[model samples]
Target: MRRRLPAVLALPVAASVLALAAGPAAAQVETTPVPAPGNPGAPPASAPASPQPLGHAVGDAGTGLAVIRVLPNSTPTKAILPGAADKLPKQAAVELGFGLASAQANSEAYLAYEKSIAQASPGGIAVQGSSPQAPGSLAQTAPPNNEAPLTGGINPPSTPLDTLVKVGALNGSVSANWSDALGPCVDTISDASTSIASISALNAIPTLPGGKDLTGAFDAPNLDEAADNAVVEQLKNLAGPLSTLGGILGGQGSAGGGSVLSLPNTLSARSVVKLVDIPGSPNKAVQSTSTLQVAALKLLAGTPFEISINVVSQPTLQVTSTGDAATSAVQYTAPVLEVTQGGKSLGRLDAANPKLDIPISLPLPGADDLPGLGDLGKLPIVGNLLGDGSPLRDALSKDLQKLDLGVLRLAVAGLNQTGAAATQPFKGYQLGATARMVDLQVLPTEALGLPNLPSALAQVSLGEQVARAYAPEGGVVCGTASAPQAPPAPAPQGSATPQLAYTNAAYHSVPLFWTGTAMLLFGVVLVAALPTRRRKTTD
Candidate 1:
């Protein structure tokens, strides 16, 4: 009976499968091509073309990379120490690099010293070693022993003598360390002065006097007397200050009881002894030489010396104008003067002729005309000597004529190329020129009765003016252009736009129009894969 029932069930299942298989064959089918509408004969519109890739284009203008090279225009008036001038330019080139290296070394040395002291201290130990008691540990270990007197440690180590000697040598090398440090400092100072002087000489502009005869002051009868008095006063003032400085450096007296040598006075025996006793006096030898040089310069200009002025000929002042371009013009005027130094009235010397072409860039400031005037003003009675409209200004103005200078163009070429256009940039500039007087009347106003005053004033003023003028011009020429180049024309309308191609066969093909289908399929698959829990079996 059971076998008969199984046969009956199998028969029904087989019949149902056969019926389902035959049903699909009877379904409808259509395969013929469909006909097109009215525009079927028309040609397909041409596709848009892709844009061409343009290469990089560069514009020509100020490149923002400029080189400034300042050539020496004249031999330096101040004599440099032997080999010093030759080394100056080279030293400046490497100054910053050398300074950085020195600073790094100094820092390392300081750090090493600190580490050594820490290592030598009582409780300090190597990181790798097991430390004894860490002050408040619950373990309660025994304190570290005396460290066996550091047999090979830095503190009385096996190499103690050698280490100590090395340390001593390093300590004694303070002078060497200081020398290395000061070298860059001095180079900076010298370079700064040279650059300043150069710029001043280049940009000097001559200022004209108002109604006063620029040359009359030199011809005054009391010029010699005034110069002598000025020198004496300067010498006296210098003596007191120098004495104070010498005493301080020599460690002689805290209350100042030393005889300092005056500018005009010869070096005293006592001063020589005191100077010899000073530890670092040799470094200051140049200062003494400079002082003597200053005195010499002053003496040559007639201060502290009796000098008579002889008018060789009245100066001839000429002015001319030239068209700089079609719309702009520049005018140049020069005043030429010829005068003799001695009482005898001699013809103008040929040496002074060249200076006539140089123009006065600017009048000397009143403060610079009087020697020790700045210091004198601080004193009670001496302050009265430098009152306004004093002889110092008149004397200085008169001396200016002796320089025989007028304005002359300073042609700068190298500057235009390096500034903003070249690779190596110029940080600063320098200028120099040789100046001679036709009769010494073209000298600066300070020179007339002040002795060497004209040269000093010229040195300071010429450098200042020239530097200020050229620095800006050089900056403009070197700076980057104000505007950037325009971009190329927008890419032509494209046929096939470039895009990232992705393969999407295995993954449901996410067509441009079927993004929604892909998202729906992904959510359905995720939900169907989740496990459904069955009810717990109950006994």
Candidate 2:
């Protein structure tokens, strides 16, 4: 009967090279011209000549700095074999050279080994061989034949292979376990597979021993081969939309949010008046003029707009006085036109028409015969005080400087209101204006109830309304001759009667009904959409 082997009993044999091939096979025999032991085949060809000993003078000079003699049991001395003095010195030099060369070679070998190990073990090394030294350490115990057993056993030992397999299995197991633990974490990374591939490629190339030259190693073709492999691995394992999602989220975190508003022109209060000439008047011409005064105008949006009007025909005149002759003084007079706005008026005589009057005044000279002194005749204090430059002149000049009103027509539009019913109310009405020569056209509303509506309408309408209501009454009106002058107030006993102030006609009541209804609807929708939360369990 045939005897069957259990898997465990066979594992030791099966896992090892011994099970595959019987010990010390005939093929292991060597058939080469081997070097003799005592001679070691004339010294290795690359060995150099021994350094000469220093002479007396040189030795004395080098006493402290130079190595006089190696200690008896030091590493270098013990490394030499006994009874081989003449050959020992040469052998020692050869061994020293061999050691240096071997170290460099070993450093390169170790780097390659480490790289191989990292690639094979994605997790890490699980088990290492008993010796920390590299595989080269076993070479000393082996026969001249390269097929010698590493552990010197009749049958090759299974320990090294077993350790290697165990390490490989452990690495695989750890990698799998770690993947399970970190599955959620991978979702958060934008390029998880690419990052893993990069790390693996970095770890594959081993670290060289300290002081070894590494510059040439990086240039080796093997490094490029390994990098290509890593790239292939990364491409194969790309995560589906996670990479895109992560990039989008990252970008959003870098930018923020706000609101911006741009208005066509600033809104302000102004005074306006229209003068129309009656046809066939004795003055011999039909003419019309619109005057406006803008005051205390705070800018609500951007730069304020400016307009100017030309008075078609007016003549210039000069005034002068002649005195110093005993008992006789000559005074000069000139005709002046009055311009008024908001109860403030100025009279100017000898103002040259067809010229742009900025409606502003400047300082005047003491000489009454000054050329432009005639122009000053239309100005407030300048015309009234004649030859004097008084405090009133300064005050009026300041007020005029602040009056920056563009032409009334330029700032407003002429809508065809002729057909509008006299009794109709203009609720929610919109207005627009255009200054064709100035190349500016603003439509207050193309659509109602838009966010920009309030601002647009205010730009055109606010100034127009203020101008219409507040322009000063030009000529005085007298009621029937018998109408008595308003009675003078009696002296106050303790305090005088409070004056009744006129209410502004522009102020209107806002419609609160529609606003409240819209707000209620919004609140209802918001409440309906909110998620309902359940209460926690008592247990």
Which candidate has the highest lDDT of all?
A: 1
Where does candidate 2 stray beyond 4 Å? Answer: 1-268, 272-416, 419-462, 466-479, 483-539
- Give the range of the ten consecutive residues with the poorest summed lDDT in model 1: 95-104
Q: In terms of TM-score, how similar is model 1 to the real structure?
A: 0.17
Q: What is the lDDT of residue 234 in candidate 2?
A: 25
Q: Candidate 1 lDDT, tens digit per residue, 291-400? A: 00011000112111112222232221111111011211111112232322233222232323333222222222233355434432211111001222133334444452
- Count of backbone collisions within predicted model 1: 49
Estimated TM-score per prediction? 0.17, 0.12
Candidate 2 residue-wise lDDT, 205-266, digit = tens: 01111111222222323235554343223222221111111011111111111001111221
Give the Å error, residue 460, model 2.
Answer: 7.6
* Model 2, C-alpha of 288: deviation from truth (Å): 13
Supply the global lDDT for candidate 1: 0.18
